[model samples]
Target: MMKIGVIGISGGWSSEQLADAVEKKTGFRLIVDFENLLLDLDTGTVWSGGVDLSSLDALMVKKIGAQYSPALLDRLDILRFLQGKGVPVFSPPDRIMGVLNRLSCTITLRNGKIPMPPTIITENVDLGLKAVETYKEAVFKPMFSSKARGMEVISPGLGAREKIENFAKKHGMMYIQKKIDFGRQDLGIVFLGGRYLTTYARCARGDSWNTTIRSGGEYKPFDPSLELIALAQKAQSLFGLDFTCVDVAQTPDGPVVFEVSAFGGFRGIHMARGMNAADLYVTYIQEQLDKGLITY
Candidate 1:
């Protein structure tokens, strides 16, 4: 029995399915809440819910929804400690943070010469307004959110300044992007362990955000263009993530990346394409174990 530690048990259909698959493959799986984990200083002991995390064969980060708080920093410290103790964490805390920080992703993609949406991150409201004017329309997204939550599309509008101020006040910085014209659909490509799993286009419901696939919105399975595939693969490598979904949008020029998600959910794809993300992930874990590529 391979003892594996998963972050949290997120209650959703896809998560449930994935959990079942992982359990069936590994036999023994442990649900760990990094916040609930404690570390002893002198003895160098790490315990969570009466289970010593150091004893686990492997640590898999799944549902670690932490923010920029002291507790979250402490959790990162614990993750580093686990790595120092020779326990393999599939997506280390730094890689996870890189994907979550919107600014970091933009810089990394831009530095790598990967095309993405024209983005502007600013602490000053004036610069933000300039970016909006430059693009004539912009989308403001939180640095640490997904599913299009806490996002507002700001064009030349009456309430644009208020929106910018409110966002700056709330998030301390404004992360804005030039909205792409995808004609209502944007590609969402999933990759696990550096291998492609599936690709689907997230279609908007009426005038909704193209990246979001939720109620009334839908996703359809399709073969992305060769350029799209390469872009997604390159982003997966640049982020150094074990599993991720690369969102891309096509303009007149070519396909531009929207954002890469480190903790993307598969409920939308499960409902639309009927492809199982959990099965792929668990299979990858098992393969690593079988090949002795990953160890405790």
Candidate 2:
């Protein structure tokens, strides 16, 4: 029997559905909170009170939740250990950090030769305002967050910087970037195995940047521009990830890299496309098992 391990058993609506769907599709029972199976480094024996995750055929670190302290963020370390021991982990732990943060995502896009809007991320409000002044159309967002929690557009002469500073003072620093004047719609490219699994776009009626869930932004299938497809593939390869959803915006300059969600949502995409992301996930896990890459 193929055993698969998943994280975040109790949180996240989409991941919960994905886990249940995975079991139905693959017939592989999932063990949640498998990070509790971590081994004591010096002893080289597994920890207590959880499934023997070391025996699972594959593992998926379902978008980890916010850890208030460093000690609470041990799931990634466990995943890395499993990977080092030849277990093929989904969205590899290192890659998780690579795509989760806005700054890291932008940096990766630049390093991978992907196109992106000019960006300015800082704590200084004056510098941020200057960037908005320079670009005339910019977006200010939280440095580390999901669900477009604090995403806002800054038009010319808008007194958004002061508001941003006030928010920043309460939160942390903000990462701001020039918003692309992309006409009409944006694309959400879900990729697996370094290739495009689905290429679709979403269009908002008016004043919308996010297009999948959380914003009531409606979507229709789209054929990605060759450039956007190529960039997405390059990013997947660079991260060496098993699955990723790369958000791209079409601008006059071409496709601009927006965000890369490592632990992306699936119910909306599945509901829209009538394809099961959970099934795809299971299939990928089995493929890894067949190759003898995953142990346990």
Candidate 3:
């Protein structure tokens, strides 16, 4: 039997969902709340306490949460161990970190030649204020955030400048951008196995920016733009990601790249698209398993 670890922070909704999907689609059992496999570097043995990492074929990393500890070094060490061995880790660790940083992602989009709104990563209040003044609108977001959390929209007379400064002081630097004027519309494109599974939804009646479950934003299937398809493909290639959720804004100027999520919101996208996305992900894992790929 081949084992594939479905990882999250012990137990999270998304993790549970993915585990179920993998079991159903690929016949890989879920190992929740247990460290089934262990590697003794000194002894050069991989054991499941009783089992072994050699028994595992792949790993679906569903959640990579915020780590504010110096222990992040230890976390990276474990990731490197598993990956270096040969286990096919879905949404590989390096790509996950790459998509999490706002500034790095901006550079990625530019390098990939993807269309996006003007953006700046700065701690200087003057520059942030100036961008808002020039464009008459802008958005302030943490370098690492999810689900439209910690997102803000700036407009003239909205007292957004001070807000940006205060936010920066507390949360490191921010990614500020001239707000896209799309009139309450946004797009989320999920790419798995180098294919686009797109969805469209409004920003919830009065909301201008965020359209997440917390904000009561509903989802529906919609056609994707040629540009969107192209950008999504380019982004996946650049990240070398097996899966991602790319958010885009429909601005008056054009579609703007909002952000790319590595452990992107899989539940909602899977539910809304109803294209069996989880199964697709499991299929990828299954392929890795069938190939008998195991690092440990």
Candidate 4:
């Protein structure tokens, strides 16, 4: 049988259970819970988790959480090393920074002519303040963040400059967007294994500006038009994402993509579409193995 692994911390929830379920249903040998693995040089070979990690056929990254103790570089190098050895690794670690960093993602999007709201990226509080003055309102974001955490709205004469200074002092950079009035709602479309998986609408609850579950967002199923799918897929292709969720919002002109998430949770899609995205992911891996995409 083919072998695979999920390199992530067991969340004490369905992430682990889901891995087990996929193993049982797919008949693939799986190694779950490979986080915090020790990397050591054994006669010039790097071994992690007390085993040769490159032995696996393929690795599906369920989590790549930021590391401090082990150093993020160490974690990233592990994946690159595995891929270099011809073990198929989903979402190559090398490609991650370019896609995850807001500034880099924006550059790629614009270069690819992907439609999105105007953005101002800077370490300068003065530039951010000017952006708010010009655009009426701007949304400030950390270069690396998710779940809408640390997101701020810059309104004119509202001490926005002071806020940007404080933010820059901490994050050292900012990704600010001219807030597009999407009317409290946005669409999140999921793509898996280079295929469309599902789409849903996330609405902010009770006047909250953020449409994230962390910010009291609710989801419902929505069938997207071809134009929307094409747009999301275009973003996905630009990122070379094996799996992702594309966040899109509708402006007065048309739909504009705001973000493409590298690690997306599928609870909302499961709730609305009654589909287990986890299953599709495992199936995709099996199909790849069958096609000999994951080399030994």
Candidate 5:
């Protein structure tokens, strides 16, 4: 039997679902939490809950941390080290590293000519203020964030400067982007193995600025046009992740990408499309391992 481990947060919905799927397939279940992980450099061993992570036949990253933080980068470094030791990590740690930070993902997308909202990155309060003024309304995003957390929408008016300053104080580097009017919904276009898998929409409830689930958004099945799917495919292809979701918003001009997710949500796909993404993903991983496609 293959011993495959899922690196994720304990008690996390998606994490647990993935572990269950893996267990069903391989009869071995291990949910490796980064918080409980210990790496002994001298022995070149990664120990977590008395299990040697480097001994696993393959590893899948479901989630690195419970919340997004700079510390997640350090956790990924450990995964990279394991990969170097010949354990095939799904999606590869280096590829995930490229998309973990907002700035790095933005740079890659922009360079690929992917359509995105006008964005500005700076540590200067004055520049951030200017960006707010230029765009009229801007979204202040942390470099490391997910599900619209640590994000604030600031309109150009009274207290704009103070808002920018306060945000900059909290996050040394400010990522300001022109807030596009995406109506009440945005699309989560999923891709598995670099191919389009499915699409879902997060419909906003109440008057939230973003359509994240935490902000009272609900997931619904969506049928996207070919153009939209192509755009999302292009954006996700830039990262080459084994599994990912491209957040795209339809604007007056065209569709613009928000970001490529490092670990795509399984709940949304399940709730909206009635598909078992965890089962599908586990099957894909098994097929890859059987074909010798996943290699160190």
Candidate 6:
């Protein structure tokens, strides 16, 4: 039996689903929580619940943390260390790091000529206010966040400066983007091993400003055009993640990429398309291990 470990939150839906899939395939199940991880540099060992993670055949990262935070970067560094020790980690810590910070991800996408909403990133409250004024309406987002958490829509006038200032005080840097009229929906284009797998749309419910499930949104199956898939493929190729989801919005100008997810959502893919992404992902890992492609 292959001993495959999963690094994720214990009670997380996606994490548990992935562990179940791995157990079904390899007859071994271990969900390694970062909180319980003990990395001993002197011994070059990473222990979690008495299991040496470095001894696993392969490790999969379903979710690094329950929420997005800079602390998650430190967790990724631990994975990078494990990878250096020759444990095959899916998605590769380096690639995940590339898309972890919103600013870094945006810079990479812009450098690759991927179209995005008009944006500004700065620590200056004046500039943030100016951005809101310029766009009339802008969304202030944390550099490290998911599910629209800590995101605020600020329109010019009426305590706009105070809003930006308060956000900047908490986050240090503000990522403000011109709010695009995306018809209250956006697409999550999923890819596995750099190949297009499926597309799901998140439709905002009622008066929510963001199309996140936490914001009262629901996922639905969507069929994207060939051009849209090509665009998403080009965007995901920049990071070369083993599994990723590209958030894109179709605007009057065409499709513009929002961000390439570090850990794509399994629920959206499953609920919308009825596809078992965890099973497919585990199978992909097994194939890579069989091919000897994940050598240290």
Against the true structure, what is each candidate's TM-score?
0.90, 0.84, 0.83, 0.90, 0.98, 0.98
Candidate 4, residue 93: how far the Cα is off, in Å:
2.1
Angstrom error at residue 36, model 3: 12
| lDDT (0 to 1) per candidate | 0.76, 0.69, 0.68, 0.75, 0.93, 0.93
lDDT of 2: 0.69
RMSD of each: 2.5, 3.4, 3.6, 2.7, 0.9, 0.9
For model 3, the superposed segments whose C-alpha errors exceed 4 Å read: 25-28, 31-55, 66-77, 157-161, 200-203, 291-296
Residues 1-296, candidate 6: write the lDDT tens digits.
Answer: 88889989898899999999999998999999999999999999999999999998889988999889999999999999999998999989988999999999999999999999999989999989989999999999999999988999999988999988899999998899999988989999999988999999999999888899988999999999999999999999999898999999999888899999968769999999999999999999999999998743
Which lDDT value does model 5 have at 127?
A: 90
Better of 3 and 6 by lDDT: 6
lDDT of 1 by residue, 1-296 (tens): 88877765556444466667778887875667665778887777789889988887777776665343224545666777887887888777778777666788778888988888788889999899889989899999887666777788888778888888888998888888998777878878888888888888777787566546543568777788777788889987898788888888888878888778877747656766897777777778777767888532
Instruction: Give the lDDT of residue 94 in candidate 5.
Output: 90
Q: Write the per-residue lDDT of candidate 3 for residues 1-296, one digit (tens) a residue.
A: 55677756556667777777877765765543323445678865455435455446677777645432224334445555767777677767777666767777778878888888888777788877887788787788776666667778878676676787787787767688876676665777777756776665545555436677667777766688787778767766778677787777777677777767777646666566666666677877687567764233
Residue-level lDDT of model 2, residues 181-294, one tens digit each, is 777777778887666888766677656665545677776777766777887777666676777888778777777778787777365467558777777877777777788654
Please report, as a residue range, the 10-residue window in candidate 4 with the lowest summed lDDT: 65-74
Residue 279 accuracy (lDDT) in model 6: 98
